[model samples]
Target: MGVLPLVHALVPNSVGNLGSLLETVLPWAGLAVPFALLAALRRRSASAAVAAGVAAVLWLGAFWPVVAAGAAADEPNLTVVTHNVGAENADPAGTARTLLAAGPDLVALEEITDDALPAYRKALDKALPHSVRIGTVALWSRHPLTDTRRVVLDPGWSRSLRAEVRTPGGTVAVYVVHLPSVRVGLFGFGTAARDRNIQELDRVLAQERQDKVLLLGDLNGSAADRSLAPLVRRLKPVQDAVGGGFGLSWPAAFPLTRLDHVLGRGVVAVESWTLGGTGSDHLPVAARVRV
Candidate 1:
């Protein structure tokens, strides 16, 4: 039982959503290890000692940064936020208004369809003067936007885009994305599409030469999810550096996970937080960064 948590962490998950789901509750599972060991020791079990040692290594190995705080930065150069506005968002207008109210230097929205684009544009026109979209994702900026184009991530459609925003500090490359969603059941957390998308996105990011780059939108996975390691290896999540608890942003009513994120490369995080619930299922995430 004690080695179970460590086994899950080290071994690749083959079952549906097994590994990913385990990540969501791994902390709690680890928390149980010590108590379980205590009970075993009280029973004078020698195996308890060995299990205790294994649990310690597993907990530390997987969550050391979380307990210690990650590489968050200070004194930001700009602020940005991201959200995956559910397609059926009951109140798109209200969600748009709520997001603009945060006054981030930039905002990225995902899961936006052609039909709802107008409402978002109208609601944000006055606040976000410059905006662009590719497929279902879009970016609004306060600075000059240039070199905007579609990033052909998947076949027959574009779920991502890139734009160069000339901020007061310097030129920053911004990529707005809504990676493919994962499915459960017999398919077993089908992530082939999302993984392929990440590979392409990582390639673009790797080739990018900008001093600072920001990836804002719904990644459909958490920073700890192994499938996202390709991007995580290249970019550091701002909230990781600037801690505020788990900062989960999905399912606004009772967020249990952080599918939305503000990731940065080269820049530094000043602070990060989740906004109050909007009409969308996702709670908006904001971050301040120094480019």
Candidate 2:
């Protein structure tokens, strides 16, 4: 487990996408260190102690940077937030209020239903007048939004969109997405559907003409996972620039892994953090970017 991070790609997933499964919860593998230490102390063997120390060093070497603080020299020009306001959330209006409290320049929402759409529009109308919604995903901006259109993803339905925000600094291309959720049941890691959607989005991103781009939403895959290698290679995660200490934002009640994210290209993230939970099961994530 300690060496999993270094050789996750080599692990096979042919049976049940085991490789992806391991990568998704890789951070938790560090628990082995403590267990090993306890065993070494109880046994009082020099070799066991050495083995425990080695595991600790290996685990920290790979994940310590995420816990350590990071800083940016540039000041921020834009603040963006993303949230998957569960389809069954009882308080849509209250959720909007939670997002508004962040005072973001742009906001992205997923899992929106027609019945609750009015509540969101009315609540965010005054602050973010410029907006666009395609299917369940929506983008609301403080500045004018133009060149708005749906980006084809998930043949079953539309859950992704692209828009250019006319900010004071310049026009920034933004994508709001909610990839298909993967399931773990009798079958092994069920990620075929989610992976297909990710590949389609990757193609859209590759053809993006804009120099500066930001993607906000619940990707349903961690940046550390190899399944997101395409996006990880093209874009930098906000948490990497501004430390948020794991930046986990899923299962709002007790988040164990990060599924929501703010990723950017040709922009600097000065601040990144997760907000308190609202009516949704997933917590909202916010980032201040230097445009």
Candidate 3:
């Protein structure tokens, strides 16, 4: 029991990497191997078999609901848009125009450059009305903003921000984050920065008091990866709720994994989908949720 909490706390920071492993084999690791060993050891003992069965059920039950709930499609909604415009993007104006055309109630952008801000601001100013920008991440909304501040993902990197938007339904706290990218080299995968970002995000989520929350940005890892488990444990992806497949959003030419996402809490996702190719490396992901 003591170790369980420790493991749970560490899970999110490792979720991005673990997701693929879990989806492919981890679920069966516990039930198949351990239960099999117990069965063989106990032989035909009815008591041992029952105990093993109970344990298997309990273990599966704990994670099944979370996975299943994310898979379900529910109604009522808030339209949200998330995108990574790439610091050296080709055309900020065109990208911003495309996003505005989608009619998102709230927009979160990552990898924004100082030079590109003006173009984006001009493109979205009229439609969005209220906005907040902190370093490379920004949030724009149609509703009034109460509080906006930078969320530190790393000691020196100010690539995340949190904003409180007052809407008709209620005040919703939205966090826009851009985590450090992990790279695979001859040596291996570099995950130090990514891991630290996840830990910081976890800390922020834990302290958040708003009942309704939305997390958006370039997480630099997939939902299936274990490194994102911490955030996954607390939030539900819009894609998981309404997307058709993986909802790939990276590399406009050929997207295989979804790196951009919109996660919600105390909100219902009605529909979610990826938008057309943008000038940036990542395609825009949008979701309509019932607040």
lDDT of all the models against the reference? Answer: 0.81, 0.89, 0.78
- Distance from true location, Cα of 173 in model 1, Å: 0.3
Candidate 1 residue spans exceeding 4 A from truth:
1-8, 14-17, 28-64, 67-73
**CA RMSD per model (angstroms):** 3.2, 1.2, 7.7
Clashes of each: 5, 0, 24
Using lDDT as the measure, name the better of candidate 2 and candidate 3.
2
lDDT of 3 by residue, 1-291 (tens): 112211333443243343332332233334453655466466977676666665566555544533343454555446789999988898999998889888888999999998999999999889999999999999999999978998887879989999998877788999999999876555345677887889989998999999999999998777756668899889998777664555778777887668898888998777777898888989999888877
Colliding pairs, model 1: 16-188, 72-241, 76-289, 77-289, 77-290
The RMSD (Cα, Å) of candidate 1 is 3.2
TM agreement with the true structure for every prediction: 0.85, 0.96, 0.76
Candidate 2's residue-wise lDDT over 205-226, tens digit each? 9999999999999999888877
Where model 2 places Cα greater than 4 Å from the true spot, the runs are: none
Error of 1 at 94 (Å): 0.9
Higher-ranked by TM-score: 1 or 2: 2
Candidate 1 C-alpha lDDT tens digits along 64-105: 655555555356678897888888887888888888878888
Question: What is the lDDT, from 0 to 100, of the residue 18 in candidate 3?
Answer: 38
Candidate 3, run of 10 with poorest lDDT: 1-10
Runs in model 3 lying further than 4 Å from the true structure: 1-77
